[model samples]
Target: MLTEKQVVELLETIYDPFLKKTFKETGAIQEVKINKEKGLVSVKIALAKTGTAEQLQVQQTVVQRLKDAGASSVGLRFAQLPFEEERTTNEPIYLAIASGKGGVGKSTVSVNLAVSLARLGKKVGLIDADIYGFSVPDMMGITERPVVRGEKIIPVERFGVKVISMGFFVEDNSPVIWRGPMLGKMLKNFFDEVEWGELDYLLLDLPPGTGDVALDVHTMLPTSKEIIVTTPHPTAAFVAARAGAMAVRTNHEVVGVIENMSYFESKTTGEKEYIFGKGGGQKLAEELQTDLLGQLPLGQPDWNDEDFAPSIYGEDHPIGKVYMDIAKKIIAKLR
Candidate 1:
């Protein structure tokens, strides 16, 4: 016959989801009551939620552990954990990559930054709020639709990060010409219906320009921040600034700036070429009073290819290195 001490030792094997440790380590399993005369063992396993899959798995595991520990009869009881109130804060620091024009590589920068942040182990989620121009699904190479569990919409995981985009719903190159209210409903559904889980950063790949889409996103996610992307040129900066100004109007913070296709490095010459001219990023940063977050050179080799996702970074590529550096800078700023 198994003693109470052995039962306690076996209960220690269960994993605790939140603490990411053993049940005994997390105090998830409280005291064990043993009735040797009746050949019965009753275990009280503290639960963090009412009906989570985790809780069900925990119970199942408890039964296995109890039997394995030599219990003739076992009874499991669950004690519900008190729910903690969510702390409301206005500063969620949602960084949006946006521009007043398309073909500015806004989505490219956003996807890379989100991936970079994930590589640094920060809880990150990327939303292709661009709706019509939802390049994120293609960029991230995620084809799976979100899993719906009751009221919860589990986000799609790609590159170790949660991502939601319209590209999953629409066909390839299909135009999404939906109007404001309809698009607003979908955007809000993504926010209210989808469970983003806990995230340190949520990078929004917004639609190009200060359109109705931006207005809707600002309404849904007011705590979001904005990151304007432009080329190292005057016209792009002006248009990109307009997008940033729109963010300010919507009460979202414009955190920083990113300049893409700012320059190119010649392989043979080993020299940096200011292909898009200079000072545009610094100029835009100064105009917006935000840091110049990053400057990306023209990526030739990592461009659209059949081998990999279009916006994904090729390992050992220089542009890929720049993304890693930018992600570190973002972490430092957040810290």
Candidate 2:
């Protein structure tokens, strides 16, 4: 006879497409009943939606995995995601930095942009919504965790910007294994549980791709705006358009698109190198009916090692000037 625990271990292999997580991680498995004599197993799962292709796939996977676990037959049922009213806020201007695919330096743009806004004497709060691949802490050189007081969390302050990320909660370089529902809950806590004082801007460094977390933000923050980041590579622009389309579909105002790594400048000869190609940002903006906010150069910033901060160029640095200009435009739009 298969034990309930064994059945659970087998079902853990099944992943939800939207959540990008296992049933076990999402706490979707509400119950597991087994009939030892009959060698039958029954499972109840929590899902965001029912009777969909993905959900049907999950159900089929459960049946096969359970049968492989020695059950003669298996029964599965799904319960919709528990409905809850998440806290809502309309005080600060919420800006989400999003990308169609990962590894285009979205987080780097987020960290620097937030810092740039703060540099202009604006109170900024940044949320690292990329739970699975969180790197904001390391990029900002944040070693300390968020301090808890009563039921609220105090965000860590760095370079004049207040920051909170999954990096502060989990072990260094550890993975965040959670389901879609959990991701929504965690995002809500960032607004409800964290004591974010008055701010001019609350920036969310969204995860790559149009996943559950991004959907949660879209649904939760109706007034929030978005900034799409993409590389100069044409293929990258194609993918980034999906992200921009999602923003439009969600009815979130797209502040603009920032073209990263548009070109590399030769130090000695002062010649421009379009290493990743050019016009991707402009193409994306035209597709989305928006403007290309700014084009960023590929280079490293000069940082003070004693602070252990990422390469955030000051207003004097060329890259820093670009960010400052973008931040000013965003401020103008918000105000």
Which one wins on TM-score? Answer: 2
Give candidate 2's error at residue 7 in angstroms.
50
Per lDDT, the best of the predicted structures is 2
lDDT of 1: 0.78
- What are the Cα lDDT values of the candidates? 0.78, 0.86
User: What are the runs in model 1 whose C-alpha is more than 4 Å off?
Assistant: 1-84, 88-93, 301-307
For candidate 2, the TM-score is 0.73
Model 2 whole-model lDDT (C-alpha atoms): 0.86
Q: Over the stretch 1-335, how does candidate 2's per-residue lDDT look in tens digits?
A: 88888877877646554443456656778899999888889889887567787788777777877777689988888887654311221268889999999988899899999999999899999999998888898898888889997446899998889999988888757888898999999998888678777788999999999999999999989989999999999999999999999999889999899999999999999999999999999999999998798999999988778878775677788999999999988888778
- Residue pairs clashing in model 1 are 94-225
